[model samples]
Target: MQSNLSSADAVERIVGFFEHLSAADLVRIGELYSADARFKDPFNEVRGIPAIQGIFRHMFTALEQPRFVVTGRVVQGDQCFLTWDFLFAFRSYHRGVTQTVRGASHLVLDADGRITLHRDYWDAAEELYEKLPVVGGLMRWLKRRANQ
Candidate 1:
């Protein structure tokens, strides 16, 4: 059997996934993930819902009022690419070092309408490393040198 859904519909579903995320809802992550789901990023290569939920929980703790706002999204077949801005404040850092990181995630949906593979592509050096005090200065210097 074949199902037909528009690209806009797929993108809506992807956006809904992030919009409905709540700290307590981490337990229901399995409902959105395939049995053999895989998630990859620069810092993590996690598989399965449990591992993904662990990362989400960590994110909840690490960022104060962390929320993902979808700026744009595109879908083609079973794959959806979403651009988003993450707004959060890290309490561990200085008193007023809140961060807004812009990034994108590519999600592949399974036949059962669950996310099978999720890959996030973003510049860590620019979004994260460059936000730090000392590291930011060093990264900026390195970037200047590389561009020269």
Candidate 2:
């Protein structure tokens, strides 16, 4: 579990990894994250590579044709920001409904080129809650009311 890549290369590798994520890739999580890495998103805040891998594993099980499209990237020193669109078809909940969640990830790589911190920024109401059946209607109504 060693890499001779720079911080920028680490970011590139991460983006490329998610673009074609599969179950087998879970074993290689250590290649991308340090043993004590922290990963946080709107719904989950986890520490360690194993927990991070678990989140991704659940994603593959819950979604169909899931992929990440990196739209933009900015790297400076050991930190980088990546803009992306997560495209997926809902498996059980909204089966067959394709959805896209535009988001960004802020990653910090350690001296070893493994991620130490990974935080994702995205709107849950717009990306998920608003796409549900009953929740969608309520979310829309609440949005209109708030706008009024």
TM-scores for every predicted model = 0.89, 0.93
The residue-by-residue lDDT of candidate 1 on 48-135, one tens digit each, is 9989998889999877878888898877778888888987777777645568889899988876567899898888999988887899
Query: lDDT of candidate 1 vs native?
Result: 0.82
Winner by lDDT: 2
Name the regions of candidate 2 deviating beyond 4 angstroms. Answer: 1-4
Query: Which regions of candidate 1 are displaced past 4 Å?
Result: 1-10
Residue 75 CA error for candidate 2 (Å)?
0.2
TM-score of 2: 0.93
Reference-based lDDT, each prediction: 0.82, 0.90
